[model samples]
Target: MKVLIVDDELNIREGLKKMITAFCPYVSEIGDTYGVQSGLEAIKKEQPDLVLLDVELEDGTGMDLLSSLDVIDFQLVFITAHNKYAIDAFKFSAIEFLLKPIDTDNLMHALDKAKKQIGNENLAEQLQILKQSLNAIRANDKKIVLKDINSIYFVKVSDIVRCESDGQYTQFHLSDSQKILISKSLKEYEKLLEPYGFIRPHHSHLINRHKIVRFDKTNGGTLLMETNCRIPVSHRKRAHILQVLDNQQ
Candidate 1:
């Protein structure tokens, strides 16, 4: 394991470094930063396995630094004089906080907890939350894949015209008349993509609301795609699908 120590005072940082090395044999590397500004840079560069961070810094607040971080994949130990910010740290099950003038016993306990919590959660959830919190969204990013011609093509959920079952293979239609065949069931992708703005108009079709140009409300409703791809609505799911589209409009 690699560790990064973030404290404004050199004395505090050095002392903490020795204590951690002496107690924890698993730590393979240690990086030190004197202030939150430098600490932020260190976090991005080093990407430590664990972070022992100070709440107060010479230039900025530790909590502010934490907020600015894309996501703390490491074990975060907030060492601060203030007790008020402890509430915020509690939200992440892995975070451990220690007061100033850290005690050996308290530090050991926090280390034990950090060891138990580190590297457990999957990376996807953290990445999504970090991207959302930073408010940096990539519009062209593809969140789903279409396995076609022995290669998986990553397609954005927004660009999808609709999905249709062609016997054993699934056909994905895009705005550019781009179609990909996946040797899987639509029901599988429905369970995966439907939660993210996809509506199932039929047992054989799944349409993206953002790409729907128009539709007929009559029985055997017709879905007119912006690119002139019209798909039939199945009687089984027609009511529920139109209701969902109505809710979106």
Candidate 2:
């Protein structure tokens, strides 16, 4: 597959090109361009299968370059600095990103994921969600992109009833009774959802506080969800959960 590296920094472009050549055996050709306008021209001319794009450029931001495009058929892996807001935006959209200075293991993992998602039809939708998430001022206005093995779901944060841990996977229970199992760990989602009022009442469960129908004290402590599902509260978390509920009242 053909790959293009788009970044303003000469060292970054050169370093990434060298790494891709040394590590990515599937990549047949590698090209690069500096700044947004040049990046646009290179993409149109070369039609690369994958683009390792920097979040900022000399001429314009990476989002500007993407906005100028009429079609996006290539897989994208964003390169950004350690900015919390930008990382959260990427997470909300379920898009692949690498933090600078780049790590070899992370690059390879992102490339592997991109390879598996080469022909996915949800790229446009994911990009849209990314844009919205970046501009969102409130967590309620933000949407999460959940990609399962067979389908991608754009779900509102408010619509999530609960998230249950399944080994390395997290199963999302939606307000509409739809369950979507994602390949990420519950710990990952717990951090992302915590700011939006999601609580980890047990090691195996992340529950939306708004989705609680009732709290049952019997059988130690249990949460009765709006979906009528009973989720156990761990002994260690029982006091904290009760405190949170009391504070809410």
Candidate 3:
């Protein structure tokens, strides 16, 4: 596959180019551009299969290039700094990103993900969803796209009542009493959903704070969700959870 690297920093572009050439055997050609305009030009000229883009460029941000692009047929993987807001935007959109001072393992992982999505039928729709989610900072204005082995679900963050860990998989309990079991671990969901008022009350459970009906102190603290599901709170996490709930109140 052909690849394009777009970043403002000279060393980053060169370093990434070297890494790709040395490690990524699947890549046939590698092209690079320093800023937004040149990156756009290179993309238009090369029409590469994948683009490794930087979020903040010299002239403009990567979002500018994404919005300005007339057609988007290639996969994208963003390179970003340790900016929480930008990370949140990426997370909500389910877009992949590599942090500053990039690691080879992470780069390889991101490239693999991008490669898998090269010929996705829903690529355009997913990009549109990403753009919308990035522009709207409010969690309520955003939607999450989840894919299981056989199906894809677009759901609001508010609709997720809780997530229960089932060994290597996570069972998502939604507002409509629907359960969707996904292959990702519960820890991944906890990080992604934490910004949207979801909390980990136990190692095996992540609950939406907005969906809590009551907290029972019967045989230890038990959380009653809006759906009437009772989730046990870990002894170690009980105080912290109670403090978080109190602060929210």
Candidate 4:
């Protein structure tokens, strides 16, 4: 794995290089840059497999750096300092991120994730989705990018009726009788969609509050979605589901 460290801080760049070289044996070549301009140049020349990128640079933010690139061929792991909103955007987009004062464990974990996702054909599309998600976060939009093996679907958050877990896959049931099964965990979508009024009524199901046609609490609770799907509600989440629906009404 060829890696690049891009940050304005000299100490941070050096510290990350030292830790990565010591702990991450998969990394073959290591490159360093101190700011956005140099980082862009280094990326053009080195074409590193993964980049440990700081959120803020001397010249511009990481988002600026991303915007300058026409096509992102390498994987990115964002380095930020306790920005919850930005982190949520990353999570919603399924992008990797590392918190500042980076722990060895977290860094290694992010590296491992990057290694798996890097070199895949879907990366460019996924990065586009990442960019869109960031833009959506800034604009307070309720759209989500859902991808399958050969296609990417940009769907409104409100149009989703429910998400059902199929092991590592989550099947998205849409309002228009369309179902998209994505290669992501239901828990991941649950966390990502929580702010958009999606609730996990069962361990296997995350339902949209706006899509529920009726709530049947008898016989351990079930929600009848607008899609005509009856999703079971767990005992633990039954009251919470009802409360969410009530609040919406």
Rank list by lDDT? 2, 3, 4, 1
Candidate 4: tens digits of C-alpha lDDT, residues 50-132: 98888889999887887799888898898888457778867866778888888999999999999998876776655665665
The Cα local distance difference test for each model comes to 0.73, 0.89, 0.86, 0.83
Q: What clash count does candidate 3 reach?
A: 0
TM per candidate comes to: 0.45, 0.55, 0.54, 0.54
lDDT of 1 at 171: 87
lDDT (Cα, tens digit) per residue for candidate 1, span 76-159: 777877544343333332346787788878887887777777885743344333323222122234467667767978787667
Superpose all Cα atoms of candidate 4 onto the true structure and report the RMSD in Å to 1 decimal: 14.9
Provide the global lDDT of candidate 2 against the true structure.
0.89
What tens-digit string does per-residue lDDT give for candidate 3 at 65-107? 8879877889989898945775786776687889999999899
Collision pairs in model 2: none
Q: Is candidate 1 or candidate 4 better by TM-score?
A: 4
How far is 217's C-alpha from truth in model 1 (Å)?
A: 31
Top-TM-score candidate index: 2
Looking at model 2, residue 96 earns an lDDT score of 97
Worst 10 residues of 4 by lDDT: 132-141
Q: How many backbone clashes does candidate 2 have?
A: 0
Name the 10 consecutive residues with the lowest summed lDDT in model 3.
132-141
Q: In model 1, which residue pairs have backbone atoms overlapping below 3 Å?
A: none
